[model samples]
Target: MIIEIKVPSPGESITEVEIGSWLVEDGAVVAKDQEIAEVESDKATLTIVASEGGKIEIKAEEGEAVEVGAVVCTIDTSVEAPAAPAEPKEKEEAPEEEKEKPEAKAAEEKKSVPESSEHDKVKVTSVAKEMMKEHDLSLDDVINGLKRLGKKEVEAVVNAPQATAAAIPQKEATRDEERQRMSSLRRKLSARLISVKNETAMLTTFNEIDMSYVMDMRKKYQQKFVDIHGFKVGFMSFFTKAVATAMDFHPMVNAQIDGEEIVMPQFVDVGIAVSTPKGLMVPIVRNAESKSIPAIELEIKELAEKARNKKITVEELQGGTFTITNGGVFGSLLSTPILNPPQSGILGMHNIVERPVAVNGQVVIRPMMYVALSYDHRIIDGKDSVGFLVKLKELLENPERLFTGGKDAGELMLGI
Candidate 1:
């Protein structure tokens, strides 16, 4: 019987997809449920698997665009996959007399070659040595096989300087160019970025935060946190928590504009922008405002791993109210991140550096980082954008404030 393998729908409203690559060759035997090919859509890359164990005949070529329910391949279930060969059993020990004869033969072969200094200095690549051994040829036989001595070879030796013979060789120059077709994911990403710039009234506000408190907290409780949570705490979790908490006071930063009215979500679903080989993917962390730091870290790690491995689903990439992107991982000092469409705000994190600043009327050094908040200015005003960043700075500078609803611990305790 022949079974057809069709392309699965990646998500809603996606009609066509490009064949990313074929994991197996044409007419190759595949096992049941084995992944045979990868399909790239505008949102994510998904795999096509075999339904039964058999020989597969590919119908769709790589890089070809096919419909959502098109048959990309067919499997001949009548032809079963080849079985694995059995392992060999242990062999009986050889006689001492037989073992000595092989060693004696090696000694005789060793004595046939001359022991000279010139031969000692000759370098042989591992591949060349292996080939010579397989052919039962000696170094002398290889040397004699090179019957011609060209002018270029003689000039290399005679024109050599007296200093060292290990001077680097000059490479020949050539002009070459190559081009490749962009995948569906990349093309979609380009279009979305351009649309975001043209459609929204985007504005960016910048601020600096003294990272001494967060750094000190991580250094102090990292081990204990890891021991209990099974993963180390990271700076992104702190920033995510801060953003979620700060949104409580300045809700407009998280609100988005509908056709005729502004829509506000009661819960915060923070999107973490992860860079992958295909393109940038934002996996939403649901209800981030209600989760703890450790829980957030573990979920981020799992979601990032899935995205990079091309195992994430389209549902995992949708329904995010806000996004946070860290350019610090790439050593970027500062960047005004572009807004993800339909979402009003995005926070950009930059690298931390030790800089001099005034503290208590004294000049001191502290670890500081620059943060940028880019929001749609149509619904968000300068006061809300600036105040949102100030609230984030307060939460991150005093990380304990995150636990107390973005208020100082003393102030909360004293009811001030």
Candidate 2:
């Protein structure tokens, strides 16, 4: 029997995808439901798995767009799995000391550095070559060291007519002639960010939160929770819940503008902005108000793993009423978050630092972090924005209120 593997629909509204790479070589006998190829859609990248055990025959080349229902590959289902190739013996193989220096292509093929430049590719870099090397970026990405080369003006490369047939003569590329195709995700992100900068009435409000209580709570429970769940319990869950609480009380902060009208949502679907190997994405948590600390931690763990593996989908990134970004994860002391448009607000979290503060007329040291909320000042007023952030600070200061509220406080806070 022959099995025709077709490109499945990547997501709702995404009808097509580009074949990023093939995991299995042609004529390799693969196990049933084994991943054979990687497909990158506009929103995410997913594996194309073989449905039946067979000798895999690849039909699609890498970097070509394929639509849903298009045949990607075929498998001769009758072929048995090939025996594993024997490892080369030490006596037959040359030692590493005898090996010659690896070329740029060899280094790229090995993927020792993930951000390696494609053949004859150019990358736009801000810093100088000396500065780049100091930052440990010697040869990872093709950050055209044009400045180091003493070139007064550097030009962007455009694709020339590529050699397609074996009969066609391959042209030796000049140092000045190379093409750099932008990834689909990068293009979309660029357009979205540019639109946000242009269209929205955006403004950022800032405040700092005392980390004393939350830090103490984590120091106490982190070990226990990690032992129980085999994962470290962190401050993100606590902050996520606190944001939810604040959003519940201040609906305008959690909503978006539909032209002349305001679109208000009753539930808090918090979008946590995660930076993946590919790009930045905001995957949302539905009804975050109901999730416990443990639940939030687990979901965060799973989502982060998915993001790293490029397994998150477009649907997962859509419909976020608000967004939360942790610049602290990248060791950021403080930053004003760029508001994710359609949604009115985005919260930026900074690293915790020991700072002096007045407590009851006495100065003392406390672990403090600066938090900034960038919102559309058009709908979310200065008072409500300040009030919402104040509520966030109160929740972080006293986390036990999440478990228990003072009589009417529960209804008021939760909108129950």
Candidate 3:
């Protein structure tokens, strides 16, 4: 029986996809449920697997754009895949005489020509020694093979400056160019970036935070956290927690304009921007406001691993109310991040640097990081944007405030 393998739809509204690559060669035997090819759609890269064990005949070539549900290959189920070869067993030991013959021959050769102390000091690499042994040549035989230098040879070495210069390696320059067709994912990304810049009234607000408190907290409790959770926590989790807590005071930052109506979500779903080989992918952490730091860290790690391995689904990449991108991983000191459309706000984190700043009327150096919030002005005003960042700064600078609903411990205890 012959079974046709068709391309699977990656997501809704996507009609076509480019064949990213063929994992197996054409006409090769494939086992049931084995992945044979990868298809690149505008949203994500998906794999095509075999339904039954059989020989596969590829119909669509790689890099060709095929419509969804089109047949990309067919399987001949009658022809089974060849079984893997069995491992060989160890051989019986050789006769003692056979081994002694080689040892005796080596001893005879060593006695024939005893090397000088100076010659014994010369190191022979394992590879060179193996080659000499294979050729039945000893160290003396190799030394004697060298030709003696004569007067003519000495004169040639002294007089030939140009020849010596030519012997040195030099880099040759070439003007070579190569072009490749853009995949569906890259083309879609290009279109979306251009649309974001043209459609929204985006504005960015910047602020600096003293990271001494967060760093000290991590240093103090990191081991305890890891021992209990089995994974280390990172700054992204702290920033994500801070962003979620600050949303309570500045809910407008999480609101988006839906046509004539402004849709404000009651819950916070923070998207963490992860850079992968295919492109930038944002995987949403659902209900971040209700989760603890350890829980958030583990989820982010799992989602990022899936995204980079091309195993992420379209549903995992959608329905994010706000996004947080850390350019600090790439050593970005500061950058105004572009807004992810439909969502009104995105935060950018930068690398930390030690600089002098006034603290209680005294000059001191502290670890500081610059944070930027880029929001759509159509739905978010300057007052909300600036206040959102201030709230985020307060939460981060006093990380304990995150546990107390973005308020000081004293204020919370005093009922102020």
Candidate 4:
């Protein structure tokens, strides 16, 4: 009996997937539930596992596009397991001695020859040959002198005050090139990016936040906060909380344009854009408005881990009121992030740098971060977008108010 293995559906609307790699070789025996191939969908990478123990017969090749429920391989369950090898009979001492002598002699001969000699041939550049001729130098002279001769080497020898013998090339650095088909995830990302640009009336508004307070707070309470919450209180939670809070005053930035109607949700499902090997995955931090700072940090960490590990589910990836992407992690100074579809806004976070700025009437050095909010102009007015960013800046700059409802929000939230 042969058990046919078919591709499993990775997510909704993802009917096709590219076969990534095969973990087992054809005709190799595999156990039940053993991972055999990696399948890449537009959104995620999934594993194809053997259904039962048997020899595998590959029906699909790597880098090939396979559809959901399509047969990828088969397991020959009827084939018997390979029998264990029989023990060898004791060898005669005379035969063993004879084998040892030949093996030792071969190894000694191998050691006598230098491995470098095997790859001594090198491509001689035209410039180098011309220089050699000009300098009246032989190829062997150049080769024997330097043991390496290129255009640079030839020039160096020629330019030197005294003429030197050319060194023979020993192993040329071969220039190799390769081309591979793009994965489904990369292709999907490109198409989605293009669609977003073409479909939405996108506009970006920029503002800088003073990180002096946030930095001081983190320095003082990062350890305590991590001890209390089992996760460090990073800049993301502050920005996420700020965005959620700012949405309360400027709802238009959070509302998405649905045909002629603008749809607004009562809750804030903030999408935290996570960069994974497959591509960029936005996992929602569901009801971000209602969660505490500690809770938000924990959820973000888990969601990000899941996204990176390809363990995140489709439900987690779908539906968000807005998105926040921190290009700062990759040392980006500033970038105008694109709006995720249906969501009116995406907040871009950049690296923090210490710079001189005016505080009150005097110039003072402060740690600052440039933040950009890209929103759909169709639903979000310029005033609302700018106001939302201003509010976010204020919230992040003075983050104590983030936990409180904005009263004389105590500085204790910042460990002050």
The most accurate candidate by TM-score is: 1
Task: Go through the candidates in order and give each one's C-alpha lDDT.
Answer: 0.91, 0.81, 0.91, 0.84
Q: Cα miss at 12, model 4 (Å)?
A: 3.7
lDDT of 4 by residue, 1-416 (tens): 98899998877778888898899999999877888898888777768788798899999999998789999999999876567699999976675545567777765544342223433454457776567656656555565676555799679767866534555456868889999788887888899999999999999999999998988999999899878777788888888888888888898888987789989888899999998877889999988889988889999999899888777877788799999999999999999999888888999999999999999999999988999999999888999999998988878777877876442355555655
TM per model? 0.79, 0.72, 0.79, 0.73
**Every model's Cα RMSD, please?**
9.5, 15.7, 8.0, 11.1
Summed over model 3, clashes come to: 0
lDDT of 3 at 78: 98
Candidate 2 C-alpha lDDT tens digits along 253-359: 98788978999998888888888766787888878888887898888878878877777776777788888999997899989899887899999999999999999
RMSD in Å for model 3: 8.0
**Alpha-carbon runs more than 4 Å astray in model 2:** 84-180, 227-230, 405-416
Candidate 3, pairs of clashing residues: none
Clashing pairs in 2: none
In the range 1-416, model 3's lDDT, one tens digit per residue, is: 99999998777878999999999999899999999998998888888899999999999998999999999999999999889899898897888766667788777666443443548854567777777766767777777886886899679767865556778899998899899777778888899889999999999999999999999999999999989999898999999999999999999999999889999999999999999888888999999999999899999999999999888888888889999999999999999999888899999999999999999999999999999999999999999999999999999988989899898999878999
